[model samples]
Target: MIHSLDPAPSAQAAMLDGATPLTQLGVIRVEGEDAAAFLHGQLTQDFSLLGLSEARLAAFCSAKGRMLASFVGFKRAHDDILLVCNRDLLAPTLKRLSMFVLRAKARLSDASENFQVFGLAGGGVPAALPTAVWSQWRDGQVSVVRLPAAPGAVRALWVAPVGAAAPTATALAEPLWQWLEVQSGVAMLSQPVVESFVPQMLNYESVGGVNFKKGCYPGQEVVARSQFRGTLKRRAYVVHAEGALVAGQDVFSEGDPDQPCGTVVEVAPHPVQGFDAIVSLQTSAAAAGGLRAGSVSGPHLTLLPLPYSLLEDI
Candidate 1:
């Protein structure tokens, strides 16, 4: 909950432009001739498909196939690529990435302070770049819709000169970010949730975070196997609870001692009643219902529908 902004308006015609904490968020700058090609081989997404106007969600993994970090990747006007992830893990994640950059032409640096980030939700997003000169990747602004049908929202970062005017679009309350994130089924991975879920566990493959046809990275073997071999045991699911929740909180099925079922991925202040979070649980426990966080006697978790369907065996 570390924010750099004051508050502003809610609904508007254009964008939800204002400084939002970005709280646990951090950014990494990658620039160079080999930046795109180099990262394509090291990360989960198909970097070759990314352009200045489109952003991609991707993950960095350990050689054993566990995720080291997950990020929302996008390109700036220049040749630079921006990797955004949870703030607390950025420094170490950067160092880890640096170790592998021995001969690559790309450079990685923290760029959190240099960027203006915001979350937009609701009916529709407007066309053009609010008040900032930052480029637009979507048709207008893009936010998640969770009405009759669920839609995946966009978490946008606009990189502009350091003291420029903030966007004139209406500012939304921070909880809207949590609400939209849950609705989109796009779970943010934190330090606690690190190395916990493989890409498919979080539905990364269904969401374009994994590219099987792409070459090798740290844990490609395990990731590819999980996708095509019918061996995935856990998957991401949206869950709502009647109490406080957090990342890494262990979830349990009724009477299941010694064997815990799942882990909480993201939790936020509920836009409505209690608290809502995203959890990755074994298909067994998830299907059994009665999933609780912390212990079998812990807060009750009610599963909700995810925005997208699973692409298992794909």
Candidate 2:
């Protein structure tokens, strides 16, 4: 059954201050003169024109247009770029990315061990940090990238060398950080859902994750077709339910019980009660209501408002 629930006031208060180590994330470093150019040719964003003071949300896709990984990428220097992604996907993503390096003068390596990653929220975020989403601010060896704020809270990604001092704020639990991530409405790609979606299925194009004018990447043709042909039948939506939800789990709608109408992209326990998740659902099913998680007769899911507006289809 589809329904609406009041926002959790306490959860909003909790999001107002805290810092948490983002151990689930890992870093992939690409260095050398061709780093940006090489990545620009391979991913869904325009890395070749990427500025030093900006970070991009991008995706790596299979030729069939399924996302294998997603990244919050930025240039640390003219020749050094960093891709922050789920730790579980780092090794294989690095290997797959390296395959086409051929003579690009770029080097890819797992640099997770060389850095510390943290998620900062509200007052826990440095006062001087850039306020614009995707903008980057750096101080010596540390870098902070402003992320899209969740309801009632500002957020940023703090990355620094391993020995740098941690942010001095009330320690936020990793679970809270995960919940804020879901609240932000941007789902990061992880191992369980690898190859499960195309970039647009998750609204990547609307969120600065795709550059349609860029030159060809692996799935460029299919992605462009989905946009221009008006053939995209599925889209990501935020949802809530009174039960546990898992990534890659199937979502069913009473309108069509023979097969799943959606897939759970990411989920987290809601601070107040139950769970919140980002789900990619067939447009028709999303409109028909009666969404269930896991199985056809599983817990009912209620649609929630997305934090950001989706771009109009071109």
Candidate 3:
């Protein structure tokens, strides 16, 4: 079962209760007659089956099956698809993605400057917002996707042209929205952690980020091997620590100082206290005695509950 964030009502209460510009995320637009066909062959998701009302969480992988970037993708039209991902990763990802376009009729370009993205939460959100996770709906000028939220908390993503007006009753601080994202246990891609994990290590497959049934992409063989052969040894987990936590930092288990047990994937200040983060580590190490962030003597860390269950038997 997925766990709820912060037992405190006030912390859980801060989600998209207002509008906040998501300045950290960047957008990529792929258009032309071959957009769908091209993406189907390049990413883990089945773009051929994508519907205008649905969004997909997918990963772009290296030939060895390590994730290069992850994206929340949706189609604005039959020939127009947009991918939203971290701003720091967009430029390099776009360049790498373009290399595979060869002679395809598709066109890929950074659309971050042309569009504005916002995070929206609370009862004040428009009544028409999509309610299911990854579900999307678009009007002539705006598009919204419902993001995963704790029980009783409502959250959504708002995307529109750069000059469009804000889409909520009021504005929320950026730090608050980022904190909410960490509590939700869905970490976005960024530079430090690039090429560091297989999709499963970050729980991407469990969260609808990987499509195993789709035909071969760059690392299909390795990904499928990990899933079917039970070779997955590390998995993402939520944890709390007292000091600053940085992504891609090493995690050490008290029982074994000789080897690092995990790597921090994402982190943010806790809305109520301390700091919380998403760490991908060895399943066995997670059960071992004490855990430390950064170095063997680094800040002590306490494991928190993950919002979703891992597919252990697979």
Candidate 4:
């Protein structure tokens, strides 16, 4: 059985109210008449029909169907869309996406400097905000996107021009926001694990990141086959370890220490002690338990219940 741990009292209280600057994230702005169509053809989600009030959690994948980057994207106007992703991967991701723009009339640019991003949790969330995950609310120059919440905490992404007034809530430590991110069970793509997975492996399909009905994209065929043919053998799960864990670390199963069974996708210090991570593991290995992080003799890991349900293979 999976074991769950309670947050430390101090941590729980801190999570109840605060906002943290998301210095680790960056923004990509896509503008022009063909922006939506261009992105629709290259990403895992359908941007062609995106509505201003809705945000999409999408993936950009390589031709082999390995995800290169994941994004929280929303339309700012009919021809303008903003994609928020890991700052470390923004330059390359933007360059790759731009390569396909060719004569499509779409323009992709790094707009990180033009905007500020913050993570709002619990009481830090603005009084008036969208309650549904992936929904967006805009007031003049500021935009707020509701994110999947962590247990006991409501979360949202706050974005605005670089010098805009910050959220009024108490300042939250970045480490706490990092912990809540892992607690949310949604792993954002980063340089360390780029091309390490397809969207489904991270439960992106279940979290509204993939659109199977959409037309062709870089890895659309492979992604579809994995879904319809039931060929997906790995999935992301939350795991806790008494020792620190880092992204890109390998995980092993005690039953078969000779072979690695998983890869750590994201990790953060646990609110109480040790660390928590989102790791993608072979489904069979995950069921077998006895997982260890870093190496065969590394720290023991305890499986934690996923915050959300995995959709049955469609």
TM-score per prediction, in order, is 0.84, 0.96, 0.94, 0.96
User: What tens digits encode model 1's per-residue C-alpha lDDT throughout 1-314?
Assistant: 10112122232212323324445677798998878877888898878766665667789999878888988776663467888788988998899988888898989899888765555443233344343212345322231111111233334444343465544445666776665566567776788988997888898887767888888888999998887886678999987787899889999999575678999998876654677788999988888898889988889988887766677534
Clashing pairs in 4: none
For all candidates, what are the clash counts? Answer: 2, 0, 5, 0
In order, candidate lDDTs are: 0.70, 0.89, 0.84, 0.90
Task: Locate the minimum summed-lDDT window of 10 residues in model 2.
Answer: 1-10
Model 1 TM-score, all chains together: 0.84
Off by over 4 Å in 1: 1-21, 128-159
Over the stretch 154-178, how does candidate 3's per-residue lDDT look in tens digits? Answer: 6788888888876846777777777
lDDT of 2 by residue, 14-109 (tens): 655789999999999999999999999999999988898899999999999999999999888999999999999999999999999999999999
Question: Can you list the residue pairs that collide in candidate 3?
Answer: 2-307, 3-307, 16-121, 16-122, 17-121
lDDT of 4 at 222: 86
lDDT measured at residue 92 in model 2 versus the true structure, 0 to 100: 94
lDDT value for candidate 3? 0.84
The RMSD of every model to the true structure, in order and in angstroms, is 6.4, 2.2, 2.3, 1.9
lDDT-wise, the better of 3 and 4 is 4
lDDT computed for candidate 2? 0.89
Candidate 3, residue 54: the lDDT equals 94
